[model samples]
Target chain A: MSRRAQENLVALVVLGVFIVAIVMAFDYGQRARMVPLPIALIGVVLTLWQLVWQNIRPADELNIDLLEVLTRREGEAVARNVSSNFDEQSAHQKRQAAGRESVACGMVLLLLGLVWVIGLLPGVFLFMLGYFLLSDHYSLPRALSYSLGLVVALYLLFVQGLGIALYHGWLEEWIRNL
Target chain B: MIDAIVAGLAALMTPQAMVFMFIGVIYGLVIGILPGLGGVVAMALLLPFTHGFEVAATLALLLGAHIATIWGSSVTGILFNVPGAAKSLTSCFDGYPMTKQGQATRALGASATGALLGGILGAIFLAVSIPLVRPIMLALGPSEYLMMALWGLTIIATFSEGSLMKGLIASVLGILIAFIGMDPVTATPRYTFDILYLMEGISFPVAMIGLFAVAEMMKLYVKGGSIVDRQMTEERSTVWQGVRDAFVHRWLIVRSSLLGVWIGVLPGVGATVGGLAAYAQAVQTSKTPERFGKGAVEGVIAPDATVGANEGGGLMPTLAFGIPGGEGMAILLVAFIGLGVVPGPDMLTKNLDLVFSMVWIIVIANIFVTIIGLGVAPYLARLPALHANLMVPAVLAVCFVGAYATRGQIEDVAMAVAFGILGYLMDKYHYSRANLVIGMVLAIMIERNLHLSLTLYGSDFLLERPVAAAMLAFIIVTTALPFVRRWWKRRKLAAAGGRA
Candidate 1:
């Protein structure tokens, strides 16, 4: 059955085609549009050419298992750390997809961003409290200690030390007015 | 020269300077011990505190912290085999082995000494090389520097495991990503997707911390396994023996410093490469090559020397040419500009003394960092074996804070986490993250330089610049040499198999 590798290849091919359409649409950009047009044009060309070559290649038939294929490799090679479990490699690949959720990455980022817009104390408080309640990384005492440490440290650094403006959230506003 | 040395010696003698030196060294060690934090990160964190401070005191604090981190990283590598930074990779080879043999103290001591020695040698080279730096830098044209950058990138293919083609693709992706911000020559956005933040482009530190630091933290959380038990054998390791191992490897320190300095002199390559390359070269030439990655003192010394040399070498281009040597140094160069220092021959003529003073700072910082680093390593070595749960929460908090503090943007934190997951997948899949980082770092320069050369001279740019043509030829030859060697080896192996 066709799997993730095939899907990735197809996605890349489709992306290449899409970029080519962008390149074509932006062909007029070189003449009329000045800086970004010409700059992006070169990037589009290089990216499209690379994607097509990588994805739409005639992959020669080999004895290598489809599931066990490594998309990339790095660092010093060792004798044993490499996965040699060919029999259930496909299943392992499926399991590895959980990593691709990448939601945790996005969520953590958004969480940090949200704090800046609101205020540091509020941000830290919300983040710790949220994690304490929601995440498996919770114990009431630990969360309390963490939250207290985070809030106090941030207050010391950004507030007491740097003397930068405290994030003007509702709590901060109330404190200021009081 | 006489005046410069006397001034430097005077600077080192100040009580305040000595105190800050210890502070910087210990700070660096602590920062270095934590995974995903390196000298660059530590220095960046310390940069804020440097404002309005006395120059010598500031340098001591900064350099001390930076030097200590290198030693700090080796602690993790030796006891747990987790590299603190890319440079510490080789430490795992010999470090962990010595640890398993219950020689953790000795290994830690040796690493500390190596770091101290390497730091001094690198700083000395930096000091001696200052006067000659300008002429060499002035001689280096864009074409030659471009070739140098390409040569560094080609090493990725040599180092990468599995398909070179895949590594190339990853590198290209990295270059393309590096293209995400502003075009240097034209000052236009290339791939900012209409975001204002994209206009300035992504900060290198933010990207690095995220890609290396945040992503790494996430991996640790998911893996749910501590590679070391800090609780096991908390007895103080032999300190004097580690110190003895250092003296035994004196020649190795000089050899590694030269390696680091040579690589550092290149425009784009910096301390990380110098450190790892030093480690690799040390291992390659060792009598017992097998002993690397298992806590060989050379692993620590080689990287430390290279890192110090890289700082000096990186300064060469940044002061002479306007181009930066590496990311962290690039920021420092910007600070120089903020202080109204221009980077050209004129500045060299007018500010030779200030340049000498800076060189002096590097030397003094290294000496102080070493003393502090050696003194602190045994104490710091005790940290890694702490329960993962405790370390994880605090470290995770720092990761978030560090990511946020870098650019003051939360998206960066997210980017780091995404990159971390990507890093983990890449790590597991055998994809070279170093290639990705290098590609990301150098991509803008390659594109911008090529664009300038093209725009300035059109397609006949190479012919117009004969030096460029020659450099291009060099780049082609260097890139091709690896494939040729690979092909020959494969052919020989296949022929032997056939004959059998």
Candidate 2:
């Protein structure tokens, strides 16, 4: 997708959520609904304004951003004063960023799944090793060293030092019983 | 007052209390340097150990750790772009840029000194203001609180990434996220959607980790570089330069420190607002406002000073009216009760020395943290040069675990991942995560107060509450001041050109 399309998609999603929230607010009693209803309505209008304004504005002009000057850093004045349009490689960069982000976020999800299934110790150990290996961050021996060291330190700190009863992996529990 | 100060010094001078205070400061730094863990978690972890300790020792440990975390939280922000806590988020604006410019040591130095001075000023302010605070606290009600929250929301004008509309949208989204759990006044779940976890609401720490740490790591992955990839400058900015910078901006430090104390006195405003407001004020007042967010020394100093002082402000309400000021204060209140100290008007009259001891702890802890922070800054500045490979996985591991640890629920990890994606998208677009956070922090306060105000005064609350009405007017005027200034400047330029 083009950069603009991606940006629009984000705005549309936010607007859709607000619309759903507005509809849901009606089901609540007067006191419960009061705040959410107006907030949702205002959100819908603001988001719509953003979407429409983005499309209609000149490509080379800056958006009528409220915090434009306030957000600028020392070197950013020149860059920020200009319009936020697609640079020559913006779409390409955006695509690459999206892909990399997905992989990174996917790794986090994998860790969560691993923790739920295998518990904190093994899950953390495996995830770190797998991430380093898969992402080509380190060689095999180095990855193992870092992962093992981290896991041991965590075990000492949390289990031994802090006396936290960590979740035992199902496999470990099964093995212990056997 | 003199007796209280002497008594406080005497109480904290005990070997056991001093030792515990040192240990607490160190432990607080460790936690504060980690993602999603802050003084709250640090205090919570130490709560169990406080049971058998002496009141002085317990206060020393608790308050010492809490004070240490204020500066400790700025470390990650200075070294990497990641803020160790929400209060530290403002530090990253100029701090991370300083790292990029190889001035990480200087930034760290300024942060330490600024925090130390801020803490001292805040303690002094609290000590002096105690007598004056009772009437002010008594005069304020829900209507006043609501206006204060609205005033806080005006800060979104400064923190937004670029577009004002996008910033407002982000703020609304943040407030909406805060509405996920049960309504404060009604007990009805607003947007839980029948999920068990939703009933408890989205964990702010978990959300913060996702928004900042997780999202930042993803950015690192995409960008493919260490935090400081450029060649190191041979001319390293000395730590003393930072100390000098803090002293040079002494006026800014004093103003921000007072702002922190003021915000701290207001129950529920918290250090987050204090930090952001200080930054906003710095930007608004600076001759070189453009230098902010790009390694301006003032940007780094102002927020640190404000947050450093906020603790003293927070203690006033808790000690005066048995009303906890913020989350950390709420936890401290619990510790106070455990220690058989009833926090009320008598706290001022009978237990005056104990209160002063708390102030002394703040002063002493600040000195300790600054010493430790400065000593480690040069060594810590070397961290940004570490390869992304080691940094990314380790940070992510800590973030995920920290998220889960906040609530000990698997679902929190999932939510962290989800919010991580959301945070990334927000960054990719123009949505301000800071604004989102401000919205979330203030949402419940705004809603609860609005309800209370309406119920008590029957919709004519503005007329009924003059203080609140005056505050609302102040908010409007302050919020418009920037735009009005810009327009006036533009008009003057145009008139000059026409004459020319």
Best by lDDT: 2
Per-model DockQ against the true two-chain complex = 0.16, 0.50
Can you give the lDDT of residue B244 in candidate 1? 85
Mind giving the per-residue lDDT tens digits that candidate 1 earns over B1-500? 66766765676667887787777776676667655567777777767667675665666676566656666776776765556765665566567667655567777777766665665666577667766765765665555555545655655544443334344545655665665666666555656667877777666555555555555555554554343444554445676788887788878878877767666666766665565556655654565543454346666566666665666666666776767777656766655654556886654556555556566666666666556655665665565555544444455565655555555665665566666666665554444565676677556555555555666677777778787778678656654554454456668989999999
For all candidates in order, the CA lDDT equals 0.59, 0.84
Considering only N, C-alpha and C atoms within 3 Å, which residue pairs clash in candidate 2?
A66-B164
- The sequence of per-residue lDDT tens digits that candidate 2 reaches over residues B1-500 is 79988998899888999999999999899888877778988898899899887799999999998988888889988887778888988898889888888899999999999999999999999999999988988888899988877877887765556567788999999999999997878899888999988999998889988887888887777777787775644327889999999999999999999999988998888898788878888877776665776789999999999999999999999998888888899999999989999999999999999999999999999999999999998889888888778888888777877777777777887898888878887876768887888899889889999998999998999999998999888888776666666667668989999999
Cα lDDT for residue B145, model 1?
A: 50
DockQ of 1: 0.16
Model 1 chain A lDDT-worst window of ten: A60-69
Interface RMSD for each of the candidates: 7.3, 3.4
- Retained native contacts per candidate, as fractions? 0.07, 0.59
Alpha-carbon lDDT of model 1: 0.59
Q: Which candidate has the top score in TM-score? A: 2
